[model samples]
Target: MSKITTLPLGFANALLVRDKGAILVDTGINANKKIYEELFRELDFNPRNINLIVVTHGHADHFANANELKEITGAPVLCHKEAVYALQTAGNSAIVPRNELGKSVFEIIKKNLPRSTKKVNPDIIVDSSFDLHPYGVAGKVVYTPGHTDCSLSIILESGDAIVGDMLVPSFFTGEPCVAYFANNEKALFASLQMVLQQASIFYGGHGGPFTKAEVLDLL
Candidate 1:
């Protein structure tokens, strides 16, 4: 059985996995490196065992320490092609230009980041949907854009979906707190509905490991 552990990376959580080897779903801010290390210690997992790193999106909080983590574990990073551009380019933000809401969130990340942070690209660039069988896992990548166009979700064979910043659960029904970040409202909604059709358990980038019913209630 594959074990998924949530490592609290402040307001967000980075998922850690234990199967044939370890896998990390995301990397939190570089400034929290020590805390992250400590968290690993508490979990009794050696960081070296993390063989693959999958970044759900390109946000700073979610990818700030990706390069460092990859170096430590010799793990290759995987992300959508859009996110690859964000990571390869040198700029104040990784978000695409012209997205008002995305810009706002990007600014927040820029304002809080350490001055010396750097960007890094993923080893595997996913242009569309891809399978994880080659990586020794029973999962596949679902290109669920609209959160940023770069946003993608992971669907395990067991029906667990790791949706990054796409459809967050809200306090109210049929509405998420924040839907699409990069001005792609239509795609975001479509992606949410698509995910619901597949997975019963929804693992969000911000607020959940929610059940299908709970996610449906919020959608």
Candidate 2:
């Protein structure tokens, strides 16, 4: 059976899927290397068995360890071209960092936390939406901009979505409703509509794995 395992790292997360072999989605900051190694070894996956490593977005917490893992697993890395640019520059020119003025002080504080490492570009760059079937995974890259122009999500054949910081859980604010904002509000809203149409379960960068109904209600 195919499965997705989340590797939470504070405000960020990585995912591991067991389908036709193990595919790791995103690799948290490189400092968490030992934890990842332990997780993979426990799952009986020899490092090289990892077929692919996809960086959902360009945030350091989500991609700091990508290069390290690629060396150990020899897996090709994939992400939207914009995401690649963001990672390669380490938020030096990120649209998200440049557009956080609208968020509350608390949110801005959370967004400014120091990152762990320098950027590393992905091996494969996805400019537009595309199918991952050629790579053996049953999913597609859905361009869901807003949080960042480079922001994207992986929509599994099962309608499960791995969205990076696109939307989060309601409980985060100790409130019944949640909030959504993007570096590009126009693109963010459009992307929200985009996901609303296709996603069944939203697995986000932060607190989530929310049901479509739950996410819709938030919208």
Candidate 3:
């Protein structure tokens, strides 16, 4: 059986999936080295057993510590083909505001978002569905765009998904919503629909692990 553990990486939530080996999704922006080191000590999980590291998107918060984590675990990094440039350059794509609240959030992000210090060259890049069996996890990385042009979501055998930023909750209310900001609403909707058909629970980059019904209620 595979189990998912949520690593509270400051504002971002990175996930660890356990099976024959472990797969880490996302690397938090701040104090990552200490967080993972402590997590390993607490769980007694051998970092060497981590085979793959998946970056949900190119945002600094999501991939900032990717380099640090790679050094800690000796695992290969995986991300969408579209996200390769951003990762390699420690750059980011333009994020469009989806609503008034999104506009406010974007302004805050522009001012306070920390710069990514390390440039990470990806070992594996896929623009379509890719199986994780070779990486020791029973899941697949499915391309889900809209929050960003390069977003990806992981669909585990357990029907729980780490959806990157495909769905984001309200910053003020802490209520689950479709997304706070989206690059393309149409694409985001399509991706959500596809993911919902395969997964029952949704885990996002921030604030979730929301149920299918909870998500639908907000939608």
Task: Give a tens-digit lDDT track for model 3, residues 1-219.
Answer: 568888877778778899877899998676567778998889888887889999988887889878889999999999998889889888886678888988888888887765578899999999989999988888899999988889999999988989988777787887787876788889988999989999999888887889999877766
Q: For each candidate in the order shown, give its overall lDDT on alpha carbons.
A: 0.70, 0.69, 0.85
Candidate 2: deviation at residue 183, Å?
A: 1.6
By TM-score, how accurate is candidate 2?
0.84
Which digits, one per residue and each the tens of the lDDT, describe model 2 over residues 101-199?
334433655656546466676788987797766666787787877777777788887778788777764334522232244567778768877877886
lDDT score at residue 24, model 3, on the 0-100 scale: 93
Clashing residue pairs found in predicted model 1:
174-219
Off by over 4 Å in 3: none
Q: Give lDDT: candidate 1, residue 138.
A: 73
Best by TM-score: 3
Q: What is the TM-score of each candidate against the true structure?
A: 0.81, 0.84, 0.96
Write out the backbone clash pairs for model 3: none
Query: Candidate 1: misplaced stretches above 4 Å?
Result: 30-33, 90-116, 169-180
The true-versus-predicted C-alpha distance at residue 172 of model 1, in Å, is 12
